[model samples]
Target chain A: MKDTALLSAPLQVQDLTVSYGGDPVLTGADLTVPEGEMTAIIGPNGAGKSTLLKSALGLVKPLSGTITAWDQPLAAQRDRIAYVPQRASVDWDFPTTVLEVALMGLYRQLGLLRRTRPHHRDKALACLDRVGMSDLADRQIGQLSGGQQQRVFLARALAQEAELYLLDEPFAGVDAATEAAIITVLHGLRDAGKTVLCVHHDLSTVPRYFDHVCLLNRHTVAQGPTATTFTDANLMRTYDGRLPTAA
Target chain B: MSEFIALSLPPMLIGTLAAMACALPGNFLLLRRQSLIGDAISHTVLPGIVVAFLLTGSLAALPMMLGAAAAALLAVVLIELIRRFGRVEPGAAMGVVFTTMFAAGVLLLEQTDTASVHLDVEHALYGNLESLIWLDGFVPGALTDPQALATLPPELTRMALTLAVIALALWIFWRPLALATFDNGFAQSLGLPVTTLSLGLVVCAAMAAVAAFDAVGSIIVIAMFICPPASARLMTNDLKHQIAWSLAFAALSATLGYVLAGYGPLWLGAEASVSAAGMIATVSGLILGGTALAGPHRKA
Candidate 1:
């Protein structure tokens, strides 16, 4: 199964286990994210949905498991992966402009001490434009609304120009227009053959937004194309009766 | 001319250079919310200086700086250990480590007879800038004399070199430093060696403190480390602009405070000037307080 996953998927996690302090948050979880598809990982709160993504990104250590991205270790392929943490994780009042935050995505390429070249600035502006944040490029991050903040984060990720994107709760607390803008950008990434993994909470937009679904509750309950895996039974297992209505 | 230069100019130049050096890295420390580390390192270095003097039996510059740097690094390491093993907040860990180290330093000082040596505990805590005079005896026409320039105290030269090095380090590592300070996780994901970058910053802060502490005392060094950068932060949202503003504020406070210390006492009919280091710290605090109240970017 491991060999088959390596051949078919861009990302594969096998028998992954993780814990915080003493209790395990994830146990023997197996997942494979298909290439060039927008995959949504849906689960109840405290079900380790974000942990799964963090483990894959090497931000969190797993107790016992293997995660392979692009047929290699995550560390070796770090440049190809872009992560957008939950907006609430950052201090919005920090003294930085939107352009400066977006420019951070190019630090890897720019290296140490070197100024951001003209073309890099152009690329950053283009990314901001892609996310519809061009006009607010000079605004302080704290001054932006929740939706605008989310868009700026998307713009920063776009500046990375990575092959795979991992976004933690991108739509949480965002307005409708920002949600639509994010969805458009996700679709654009998918259409361009880039992969995206989002930790999504709202059950109503699962089918409309995602091409693949990974229903998780400390372990993988179901994983496959959205049509077959996003069943009411799998969601019940993932959400553990907290899911209000049957789909 | 010689009298003015000998009496007032050296301390002003020394204060400005020392404050600039401390404020440069203080900007990043403030951004990272580790401003107390400056205070911690400054206090802990006292023990290192005492131990180095005991070991070397001399008041040489290099030995004292090395001792101070070692002590600062040790303080950081201890703080980390306590925070990790003792599971306390970083501020509390720093408070415990620095206060203990400072007490040890004071105890060591009490055990030694330092009257014969130039090392005075009171002078160390509150610098004696008024005593830093040219060794050439301030003859007439001494301002243009090469021999007089050579006789200038080494403290001024040391501070000048420190300022140059601090500026160079900030310029050379601006990108990685900014990225790591702003977002450590993202910087690490980009394979930027965030841990090493953070350690380098702490080491730089330690070195700056060592270079300035002898002439300005830990009080002024601590104030400069937090005040100028923090005031600059309240005035600008851009990092580059913030650095520039911080340097400006540091220079302003040093010059203005020196003037106030020297002349303000005379205006009030006092016979002599007060402590230059203390006055500089007081002025920096006033500037910060004023900026916090009236700066354009003051938080609502």
Candidate 2:
């Protein structure tokens, strides 16, 4: 908890709650994402991790409280944040290519009536290259494997060039090699002074990959460095210790 | 044989042109899952035409048509506003806006003897193809050859031009439109004017529906707008491919439906004229049904 006070907060969510059709999914949740680190939100199923991230990005409406990004309201300053929704949320059968989906990250910048400039296209390709997905740029989205689709979404988020990134379950169902590739890219981004918040599973890999961890279950169970807050006690509280607590 | 030619050519040409026009905007709407919005606006345009007629004292093509276009555009804007501010479901918002506008139009038509004035709401629904010949013509002095110079009716011509404009607009803004349709939040984060883009798409769809009203009637125009693109979607997952295939199917359906309307009943030895619009829809439906049935269900 001492490390949490030392880290500079980039996103501050205060008393945020979300509901779908009047059934509350997240209740009175509060957490701060520190600047220039990879923070993994780990919790059991239905822990409201996804809802918290969505609320922080202003994607989901909060019943009460507010989210401030870089000391400003999220709505007034949208360009600073970019969100990568779960791969499952999209209709993969949608009529678009990998490069096109990546290019869509620039839609907020280039706009509706305007065309994607040569520079934008070049940047999109560069982001794809960062994810090692340049070869599949022309392929349609439905033609992609699960890991490949996740990488494409990562490329899209990277293309945003925003100060903060929010990714929902980017590692679900991906292979080891793809995970390594993604982590490598994410680590580089983190080192470059960008904040990356991922709603991650696989608690075993948290100590190796993330510098900070938020153990949440409807509310913040613990928040600190991976070594400090990711102890057996926190694991029990977060996931009820289904696996070995020391993983 | 000549009688067949005489009765069939007008409906064929009109239906083909209208169906083709509707397909252009319908492709995008179907992709966006808002195809039913087209049906709502089409029915809503009747009162607009009636009002336009009341002010002008005749169904003077320009004013009446412009009124219909404006009303349809209003319906789209209202639907958008409700979705944004009311936080209502998009489908429900469309239903509310269109139904209200259409009901208003119906009331106005009934109050005003609009039918005798040639701006009838009934004719707007089941368009009389036989009368289209009397109403149809071309730009008088614009043609080099007297025969090829024949133009469609002023209303249909305007509708065709409006469709061309919408098609051109879609071409110019295809990438943003595609991106927005897929993920609106991403588009907004990138600094795109998402509201404007969405509104523009709805307006374009409304324009297409207005143009389509004179040929196929409002009820069936929905099929023209939804079927080809939906069928095309089943065949491919590329936007360009979908649009191209939809256009091809739309043209093919128009030709087949036109020919069927002319000869299907005669071939069956019945004294009846096949509904060209209905047949066009049926053909497109068959194409979609066949695609759905035969498509590979497992991951390719």
Candidate 3:
């Protein structure tokens, strides 16, 4: 039974419900993300898309839910998980350099007296290189363009060296070139047997970018291989009987 | 020379140490957009101290600190509860909590027959800085003399130790603190104890405020906590450089403000020296104003 739990999925959520003083943002949201695949969670505006991800990361308190990664609580396996929050979630003008943001990914390794040794710096630099942000390592994060800023965050996540990566809107407001760069990196992560889940929009790019889709509004509308489940019917069902004009 | 060592040096040292202690945590607070927390914590200290004095019937430091820490913790918890349950914004929640506590303190002072003791609102606002005189400083070669060092004002030793403790805390928790302050969700995802770390930061700020409350007074600690770090934010894009700039700015403000308050009136042909704590806060404000005008990152 334990072996089945471990081998079945990288992430699973059951009976997840969330609300904030008003109405339910998400209700009975169940999801299962397969291991070593890139999955996109698509939904329309105010659809609890971000809430689902937040709940899974334990960033938000769900009304009724259970979440597990590798058959264990997320808290138990947090060291193997990396999360990239939305770009709009933080102040870009904060006093920090690109290299410093990348090094933040490695903070879990350092104990109380957080002294970044040479190897840590080397690791951070290498992660920046992975995201093609090595040249801008010394620059402040506020100085970067929107796309460059996203890349820097991606670099920070790469520094974590985790078994699973969860990104919220990795392609939002990014230039085409940066979008390409990000997808390539996501693909690399998948090829390396790392589970990748992204809260995504842009239905036009859904089938192109992701191998699987979890169509959601307040609850899971559809889930499976993109070719089979990411159909016009599922998109309409998830988006409330009306397909959004290509955004 | 002897006169300088006996009267001026101790107050100046106390002021500098106090300023440094507050300014260290001020950097993170300013960056986190929670600068008014310093104001809130310092204001709440009055009620805490008053309660402590009422309980112990004494002016000992430990009881005062314990009471202040407890009050600060309560204030923070209250602010959070109001923010979360009451749906009030964080700033508004803080404003309500701290001001109410401070008013309660004033009422307590009025209600109690504490005039016999040296506890007064005036003393809490503008601490008696000139009284931190070091009799040991009058000894020749006092810098090297162990006996003279032992005779230094307790306020000076305590302020210096406060500064050291705050600096060490900043250094040790540098990573988690920066991570949590910058992006709370990301830090939590990385398994950082975000709640504990933030509470620890507030504890550090409150500790500095309580310690400096005696020497620099309860009010001016806000300026030291704000102005230096705000100016440093304007000056630098790197947290490390910003911290260095704030420490330098803090020391400079303390020294320059002390000298100006002590001698500027004399140079302008006045009789009495003005308030050193007031002058220090004013100097820091002037520095902040200057940086805001011409700082490289001012636009940001």
Instruction: Compose the digit string of candidate 3's lDDT tens values, residues A61-136.
Output: 8989899988889999888999999998999999889999998888778756757899999999999998889999
Model 2 residue pairs with clashes: A108-B190, A108-B191, A108-B192, A109-B190, A109-B191, B47-B105, B138-B151
* lDDT (10s digit) by residue, model 3, range B84-166: 99998988998899999988888887788787755777767877787888887888898789988888888888888888999
TM-score-sorted candidate list, best first: 3, 1, 2
Name the candidate that leads on lDDT.
3
Model 1 has fnat of 0.59
Stretch of 10 with least lDDT, candidate 2 chain B: B134-143
lDDT of 3 at B5: 93
The residue-level lDDT of candidate 2 at A195 comes to: 89
* Interface DockQ of candidate 1: 0.64
**Model 1, span A1-247: residue lDDT tens:** 3446447477888899999867899999888888899999988888899999888887788999999987788888888888888888777877888888888888778877566788998888899999899888889988999999988888989999999998999999999999999999999999999999999999899999999999899999889889988988788778886786555
Give stretches of model 2 more than 4 Å off: A1-8, A21-23, A75-77, A113-122, A235-247, B1-13, B39-114, B117-125, B134-152, B191-196, B267-272, B287-300
- For all candidates, state DockQ relative to the true structure: 0.64, 0.40, 0.80
Best by TM-score: 3
Instruction: Estimate, for each residue in B150-206, the C-alpha lDDT of model 1 and write its tens digit.
Output: 888788999899889888988898888887787776776677777788888877888
